[model samples]
Target: MIHLTLIIVDFLTGLLAAGAWALASAGGAIAAVVGSGILGVSLFRRWRRRD
Candidate 1:
C-alpha cells in the first residue's frame, strides 16, 4: 500500500513539472515576439524621423 502511494505521488509530481515547463516555454515565446515587434517599430520611427 505504501509503495503504491509513493508511485502515485511521483507520477503526479512529474506531471506537474511537465505542465509548468510547457507554460513557461509558451510565455517565453510570446514575450520574445512582442519584444521584437516593439524593437522593430522603434527603429522604423527613428529612421523615418531622420529622413
Candidate 2:
C-alpha cells in the first residue's frame, strides 16, 4: 500500500512537472513571436522613413 501511494505521488509530480515545462515552452514561443513582430514593424517603419 505504501508503495502504491508512493507511485501515485511520483506520477502526479511528473505530470505537474511536464505541465509546467509545456507552459514555459509556450510562453517562450509567444514571447519570441511577439518580439519578432515588434522588431519587424520597427524596421519597416525605419525603412519607410528612409525612403
Candidate 3:
C-alpha cells in the first residue's frame, strides 16, 4: 500500500512538472510573438513618418 501510494505521488509530481514546463514554454512563445509585433509596428510607424 505504501509503495502504491508512493508511485501515485511520483506520477502526479511528474505530471505537474510537465504541465508547468508546457505552460512556461507557451508563455514564452506568446511573449516573443507580442514583442516582435510591437517592434514591427514601431518600425513601420517610424518609416511612415519619414516618408
Candidate 4:
C-alpha cells in the first residue's frame, strides 16, 4: 500500500516538472520572437533615416 502511494507521488511530481518545463520553453519562445521584432524595427528605422 505504501509503495503504491509512493509511486503515485513520484508520477505526480514528474508530471508537474514536465508542465513547468513546457511553460518555460513557451515563455522563452515568446521572448525571442518579441526581441527579434524589436530588433528588426530598429534596424529598419536606422536604414530609412540614412537614406
Candidate 5:
C-alpha cells in the first residue's frame, strides 16, 4: 500500500511538471512572436525611402 501511494504521488508530480513546461514553452513562443514583429517593423522602416 505504501509503494502504491508513492507511485501515485510521483505520477502526479510528473504530470504537473509537464504542464508547467508546456505553459512556459507557450509563453516563450508568444514572446518570440512579439519580438519578431518589432524587429520586422524596424527593418522595414530602415529600408524604406524617407520623404
Candidate 6:
C-alpha cells in the first residue's frame, strides 16, 4: 500500500510540474502576440500619417 501511494504521489507531482511549465510558456506566448499586435498597429498608423 505504501509503495502504491508513493508511486501515485510521484506521478501527480510530475504532472503538476509539467502543467506549470506549459502554463508559463502559454502565458509568455500570449503576451508576445499581444505586444506584437499593438506594435504593428501603431507602426501602421504612423506610416499612414507619413504617407
Predicted structure with the largest TM-score when compared to the true one = 3
lDDT of 2 by residue, 1-51 (tens): 999999999999999999999999999999999999999999999999998
Error of 4 at 22 (Å): 0.5
Pairs clashing in candidate 4? Answer: none
* Higher-scoring candidate on TM-score, 2 or 6: 2
Write model 6 residue lDDT over 1-51, tens digit each, in one string.
999999999999999999999999999999999999999999999999998
What C-alpha lDDT, on a 0 to 100 scale, does residue 1 get in candidate 2? 100
Clashing pairs in 1: none
* Worst 10 contiguous positions by lDDT, candidate 1: 1-10
Query: What tens digits encode model 1's per-residue C-alpha lDDT throughout 1-51?
Result: 999999999999999999999999999999999999999999999999999
Tens digit of lDDT per residue, candidate 5, span 1-51? 999999999999999999999999999999999999999999889889564
RMSD per candidate (Å) reads 0.8, 0.5, 0.3, 0.7, 1.7, 1.0
* Candidate 2 Cα outliers beyond 4 Å, as residue runs: none
User: Which residue runs of candidate 3 sit more than 4 Å off their true CA positions?
Assistant: none
For candidate 1, what is the TM-score? 0.89
Query: Residue 17 in candidate 3 has what lDDT?
Result: 100
Error of 1 at 38 (Å): 0.5
Task: Quote the positional error of residue 20 for candidate 2 in Å.
Answer: 0.3
Score each candidate by Cα lDDT. 1.00, 1.00, 1.00, 1.00, 0.97, 1.00
Off by over 4 Å in 4: none
C-alpha TM-score for every candidate: 0.89, 0.96, 0.98, 0.93, 0.78, 0.86
Q: For candidate 5, give the lDDT of residue 42.
A: 93
lDDT of 1 at 4: 100
